[model samples]
Target: MALNEDLQLQALRLLQADPARSQRDLAKALGISVGRTNYCLRALLDRGWIKIQNFRNSRNKRAYLYLLTPQGIDAKARIAARFLQRKEAEYAALQAEIARLRAEVKADAET
Candidate 1:
């Protein structure tokens, strides 16, 4: 529900989907700043949720791949479930508000 949690979940999914994407590319996909992406990634790395590996005999020496650890995979699943629950709750609330506002508008028109 918090911004960071959402970002973390999103980042996990993206990395799981494609770890080869550059940080800039990941930022673009997540719709966050590169700085923010780095911050989130560092947090994940520190937590031991993910690990970065350098390629062997690769052209781009600086290029690295992000991989989720076993714990990270489990965390991703849990976070995804929580995010879905939160979003569903938000959707229900918004639908209720829209209905209430529509009733108010109809009442105003009748008067």
Candidate 2:
């Protein structure tokens, strides 16, 4: 997956997990710049996948919460399924390669 796609997926998961998380905090968790985080958020919002709500916290009254819309949840599911499928394929390939290597080593040792 590309950076934008990965960023979107991580942002969706984190926002779904914790709506009240700050953008700066999300950026830290995502290892991306705040500007990039904002860009992702804007894209999600534009797609109507996520919504922002105002919440008053002890320290910040203007804190904005990122909540996933129903559409966002559905999208997240699809993304997760695709990611799992790709990983499974990669794992199978790795296993096959390992087996091949082990057999080659055994044959060499026998000779």
Candidate 3:
């Protein structure tokens, strides 16, 4: 299955920590591809969860840096909280499922 909202939140966290990161760098960090990273970034930008700023890099006149806007920071905070809650819920559900499966297996063995 595709990565859930939790992973997306994690991506935001990474971006927040290092706004100057390139798509390739982010992909490497996230264990995804550059293309995928670009896709995710576009989605975040569209949702106003992050932003891109063009600032000249000291090392290269043509190179630019990206910075997060205030709104992006707020959105990251909100999304991070929501992602944590959703992850907790998913974990609980998985635990319950495992318990149910174990019980079913035990019942079958007993029978």
Candidate 4:
């Protein structure tokens, strides 16, 4: 599956917060299937945005750590800025719409 920018940003944030989290946990938090999470992770790895290391001390041999590279950190910042801009614009539009609706309601009440 194609990894969208939103998913990429969220995954990066989650992994950065706790690199030792399992893929299943990540997928659960992300509300996506494990397979899709795996795909997204592979894409991130291929892009050099993230690096994976096995956790030797963990009892679960399959346990791994996902680390964000410098590039990934920079990418996450950019993505977060863009996401904030979009949300701000959407909020402004919604605010305007609410004002318009309130005005209509007031006018109807006055009539």
Mark the 10 consecutive residues where model 2 has the least summed lDDT. Answer: 1-10
45-80, model 4: which lDDT tens digit per residue? Answer: 999999999998888899999999999999999999
Per-model CA lDDT versus the true structure: 0.90, 0.88, 0.76, 0.95
lDDT of 3 by residue, 1-111 (tens): 354576577787888788878778889998888788878887777767776776554565544345566776787678778877888999999999999999999999999
Misplaced by over 4 Å in model 4 are: none
Tens digits of per-residue lDDT, candidate 1, 76-107, equal: 99999999999999999999999999999999
Between candidates 3 and 4, the lDDT winner? 4
Ranking by lDDT: 4, 1, 2, 3
Q: Which candidate is the best by TM-score?
A: 4
Task: Provide TM-scores for the models.
Answer: 0.88, 0.88, 0.66, 0.96
Itemize residue pairs with steric clashes in candidate 2.
Answer: none
lDDT for 24 (candidate 4): 98
Candidate 2 stretches with Cα past 4 Å from truth are 1-3, 56-59
lDDT for position 107 in model 2: 100
Better of 2 and 3 by TM-score: 2
Residue-wise C-alpha lDDT for candidate 2, range 1-111, written one tens digit per residue: 134655678889999999999989999999988988888898899888999988865467778989999999998888888888988999999999999999999999999
Ordering by TM-score: 4, 2, 1, 3
